[model samples]
Target: MAVTRIAAAAAHFGRDLDHDLGRIGKLISDARAEGAALLVLPDAAIGGYLADLRHPDPEALPPALKPDDPIFEHIGALAGDMVVCVGFCEAEGNDRYNAAVCLTGAGVLGRHRKVHLPAAEGIVYRAGDSFAAFDTPVGRIGMLIDYDKTFPESARTLALDGAQVVACLSAWPASITNAAPKMSQDRQSRLFDLYDCARAAENQIVVVSSNQTGAAGGMRFLGQAKVVGPAGNVLARTWAKAGLAVAELDVAGEIAAARRVLRHLDELRPESYRVSR
Candidate 1:
């Protein structure tokens, strides 16, 4: 039940791998300076997300990296004693997937390819098949990529797999078609926050979320990175800016307290849930 400091970053990343790595290094250093044991960087931190969500140019897509790329070692070296989670476009043969990976100085601890694809996302990346939780230095953790968190079943599957903390790495953007003048008035802004808080509260698991800032082509990202407690209360947030949302908590203790009154996971009636194959 030791208290752990967590940091979620909201920053802009582009197609330049070198520039993105430098920015990521700065974020890792900043989080480490704040005594953060766990840091979650935004989705597409390695390269970047699609320039246009609906009509992404196939030639202008983010550069996909292999799982065993030397840059991962570089990131791990920078992580040192901290547990870091990051996202990137993954290349597997001729196929590519929007993916995330967890690592430390030791190497990769776990990895997840996005399971949910929104609109034209399937046009560029292949969808993953499952959700899984894995052990890390901090604790048992699971990961969700962007649109994956929009569904309750995504987080629920991870929780059922014994995840204590969920790192939701997103490159989520503001409304594409229904754009709003004010960032706060944007529909995606509300839905982003709603999903983060709702998923954490419903699963009673700590959620460390991060998103991209600034615009990539026609898309303007929403950067409401945050750390949400198991009770759904946002412990800290970067709001609509590019920065780190940092918070400290005893992960196991908070989860224990939240579930003590009514254990949501344990009380599930699987027989009653109807689903399509």
Candidate 2:
């Protein structure tokens, strides 16, 4: 079994494209120096997230870039041999999406446009329609953005599609309506960690979670980046601070061990489960 080092980041980023790129480059360099084969960055790491999640100002929306924009070219060049997953506002013709791309210097390995829209997000971005797992140097991987992790089906779909590791990127903020006394105690903070562990354990897959740190616009972000094992054990984490959570594990071996007894994906009774249309 080969051990792969993976890193998840909790860092602050904003709308300035050039500055954001430089920050991302530095994060990549640091992750590479730490021997991380894959680095997962926060959502909206390129152009920043919405100023307010509950009541967004249309004029303050993130700047959108094409999927194959030069900014990604720059990021790809900086990535070199390491696999990096970063979120950005995607511009496809006239429509915009809140999307994340898994890439290496070679090019994009896979891309996920966020499927679940929460609160005011749908006001600015179009929702994605499907979940898929794709191959990378690290292993079979999938991606989900922010609120997407709140839904069980999102990660389950990826696991069914053969994803061994799922990277969840977020610009998740503290409770917008009910602010906590401390960032750590925020409702969103608890939910973020909860969903991370639940998704990893339930799907029997490794979960790499990253989020925006500090404050952007009027929103205060909760930075609890973490790496959760298949047993719902948090191997590494960063709480309410800007940092990188790193872990080294034998991806294939760990998953095999986790599923030696109960294969959650194989024992599902989908027909018995019903959802109202």
User: Whose TM-score is greatest here?
Assistant: 1
Q: List the candidates' TM-scores in order.
A: 0.98, 0.98
lDDT of 2 by residue, 107-201 (tens): 99999999999997898899999999999999999999999999999999999999999999999988888888886678988999999999999
RMSD of 1: 1.0
Q: Which pairs of residues have clashing backbones in candidate 1?
A: none
Off by over 4 Å in 2: none
Report how far residue 248 has shifted in candidate 1, in Å. 0.6
lDDT of each: 0.96, 0.94
How high a TM-score does candidate 2 get? 0.98
- Looking at candidate 2, the ten consecutive residues that score lowest on lDDT are 176-185
